[model samples]
Target: MTLRRGACLLMGFALLGGCNLSLPLQGRAPQEVSHRTSSFEPLAEAPQSEILSNLIQRRSVIAEDSALGDVARVALSSGARPSEAKLRTAKLRAEAENKNWLPTIGPVVSLTSLGDVLASLVVDQVLFDHGRKKAEREFAWADVEVAAVTLSQDMNDRVFTALSLYVTALRGQEKAQVGDRAMRQMRAFNRIVAGRVTGGVSNLGDLRMVEDKTQSILSMRDTAKDEATAALAELEAMTGTRFDGQPVAALAGLHDDGGAPLEVLKADAEAKRSVAQATIQRASLLPGLNASGTVSNSGSSATLEASGETGIGLGTGGKLKAIEASKETARRQVAEAQEDAARKQSRLEQRIASQQRQQAEAQRLAQQGQETYRLFQAQFRAGQRSVLEVVNVYEQSVRRALEGVDAKYDVILAQLELARDMGLLADGDAI
Candidate 1:
């Protein structure tokens, strides 16, 4: 009977030793994609839209910026954001690590089928950890707040990126328009040169001169087309919105009246979410109670054990002052960030104002040049000017016109950037 009991005990331990008890470490959820939706670029069949109205029709650039930013925010929360899944997983790991603080309990029972069988339940509740366990929980929560701040910053960066691409798309359209106008002027000059060559008034070399200019304009056209395509593709990739036409960025200023400043959003979450949570770590420095008990019965025999632990010894209560200091640092950092953002925003606004002033000057020059071209056209028909002279004025006018277009869009780009910085670039607020 003694040998049988010893064999059973050894076999039970061996079997228990072989039992798999570790956590099921899942392979990191296959590389998280930042794009909220599967990218499918369909065959583009819509007519090319060149007016700013295109932005107004489907969605404003600012609106799209805000929407995509929100989408990315959701992705961050769901472990789908770029590099965010790991951070989110870390928070989960922190919480899982905290489970170690809970007491480990075990059962002490006789392996028998008879009445009055011996049994005991032993529990070790490691409580009153002088704020250690509480601090750990708060720290885990703080990690989540850190993740939120990271996501908000990431979303802020993406908003600027998307808005910049929209501006690029707008500028590309301007280039395409200028290229188109230049090509038309080149064609007219080539026709005049061909007439002179046929009439023996000009040589083949003169005709080739106009043709060379035509070729240069053609190259510019091709370059513009390529750039437009690239900008559209990049926009589509980032925001999942097809850019088939010119992006019209209507002036959308940031009217952030009620929303919290971006700096506050950038702070630790507990501090942002609750005032009491700011002192959470300090509260953790106090000892917490850990209560444990054991009870056993075998026929007429009975036993009981009850005990508890209070935090003591070694570096306890020393870091509470440091934790309090960090809370103050967080607040100061928030204020500094807000001020920096404000300064940057002011710089963009000043630049936009400057661009607007330059746009007006360039438009005036373009108008005067256009009038000169018109008068030169009449003079050529009336034999007061040559085709070559007329073409020179026409080229100069076109250059001025292109300059005006560029200047106008530069202001628009600056305005969009300012709105992005303010974190309120929405579709509905018109310039």
Candidate 2:
């Protein structure tokens, strides 16, 4: 029997080793991926109005459409041609110029007919001005820049809105949680009061008061639920996805470190804006280069007739002038982009500072609430306080706790907003 037991124990040890028991065990209870446990969880799905605002500012439907429309206008106004059209036009013009200079080489065709063919080619080539081509390229480039900037701005704004919604929702959810706890406590007190009245230890008045307070808590809870629902809907609309009713992930605790310097960011944006403007201005002064070839055959005799020309040509006219005109426009765009960046930076700093102050005030209030609760508890325990007094103190404590959570969320939101304004946040950081 002892031998058998030893063998069984050895087998168990082997099985345990095979099971990789050395791996660290997860501390949380088994749960679905959708289920989350955090005071800030509900707010995770909450819509951030700020992120929406930012998205609207950066990449709204109107802005995207406008950018596209501008690109189209640039293409049209600049007379930018498709690659094939440009190649054909270049070839035709080059052939025309060549015919104008070089005598037609073909079978013994009439000199009068050759002269007519050469004249036609020259007319076609001369009709397309060099300035027009240059202007088209410049306009195309400007349109590209406009589209890029609009897209970037749109993405930035959406992220900001998502972050704002997330934080606000989290604040509201935390308040709801506090209210839930308060209601539970109030219900328990109501039960206790009922038992006391039944046992003749408490009067009818006490029971009725406790009941009324419980009803009041329920009312507050309903209001919070409504607010949370609205926030969730808003969040869903922005993200264009559904959340499984999970809470938002908690942000790291606040640190005393200040936000990034707005002046530095403004300077960076200004520098880039200047570069963009320079590119636009330079586009106007430069002439474009193109090469083309063409083959044509005209029958002047029963035997045969053939002519061809291949060469390079430079043309300049209306388009180049338009590009020159756009230099001032490009400079203005750079100035506007720089000013906007600067304004954003300043606003971010001010918002962070303001949120930090609010958080400090909230912490103070939470501390005061705790102190008051302790005093009230002591008095109630000594039978020096009524049940109503105890309930009020508890409710106050709950409110204070909710306020503290909200303040923390606000700080997180402010940080997120600052990050967004700096273009640090990505799509994955939407929450």
Candidate 3:
């Protein structure tokens, strides 16, 4: 019975050992993992600074500038005119017809088939028509303001998008540099291991292990390169130019210390939009005014060849009664636009705040990771820790560093977005 119990215990211990061996390596390998490392050719001697320089130069803060130009051209062609011009035209037209009730004396003329002729001149204008002219002028003015606001909004969007792309590219380039350095370190380690194995100081196993680790690093480097390439491509697409992989200018002293409050910006946009609506409403209540005049002369004689006589008169016409109905519709539309813009601004602010909080947390975690790595490094050098332990700590350090970089980038981007929302972006502030 005693022997059987001992045998059973031994078997159980063996099973447990097998289980541990089969389990995944959750911490680090007993030896460094070896794999093919990614390779990159040296940059060509050609000067590629122009490629990125052109990209920055091509980006525009005012997207609506072009659109506004187009709109202005169309408006001019269609006779929509600026607010000043429209007001002037309306005033002149109103003045010409303001004397509708006034009576005027002039020569009169008439002609008959029996060779009789009569001549006369007459004048007339609107006596009164409520507040038609005033309303029309107000509506025209509102339209002008609406166009200007829309242009400003478009400009803000364009500038923000360009800057976002620029920042992304810059971050990508930094990551690629890190990957390159890692690759170089792995290569050097591989060479050392190879020499040790040849001298019989280390066995084939150690060499193979180092080779595998190198390859893994290479793969990571490849991924980083791809990421950088994609970022550059996106930047190029935005700026409508080629990028030769030049670094973007560092963002320093770019943030505004006195950024306009979100509430203030929202209020301003709403106010301008409201004014546009009011103008439209007011314009609808006004009536149109116009005047016409005609005159003619004829030859006359005592015989059948006598020429006919001519007469002249003046009159004016336009529709003012129906405009008031249209004005009501326009007022409702303006209200809707103002509400929509406010909602968008609110959502943006919330997102930025959330990202900022997350970044702060990440930064704390990274610091902790750094301290832990230092402790592990000291322990490893003293021969009290295995190679695997040291590698695990190094991996942790890399991860923490990446997280910190990402968090920093996120914060910068959020600030940029806020600036854009407030319409504070400028042409010279690319990335």
Please give the CA lDDT of all the candidate structures.
0.57, 0.49, 0.47
The TM-score, computed over Cα atoms with residue i paired to residue i, of candidate 1 is: 0.61
lDDT of 1: 0.57
Clashes of 3: 31
Best by lDDT: 1
The residue-by-residue lDDT of candidate 3 on 1-431, one tens digit each, is: 53444344344434433432232236654755435211111012212322122212322222334432222222222322243343345335434433322323244576778987755332222222233333343333333333333333344555556556656665666666756776676676567667867887668887676677667666766776777678667656555555454433222323433333333333443443354444444334444232212122342111112111222223111222234344455456556655765677677667667766777777787788778867876886696765445555655655666666676677667766766665555331222
The regions of model 1 sitting more than 4 angstroms off are: 1-141, 152-167, 197-213, 236-241, 246-249, 260-264, 268-289, 296-327, 425-431
Best by TM-score: 1
The C-alpha TM-scores of every prediction are 0.61, 0.51, 0.50
lDDT of 3 at 211: 70
Model 3 misses residue 171 by how many Å?
0.9
Which rank order by TM-score, best down to worst? Answer: 1, 2, 3
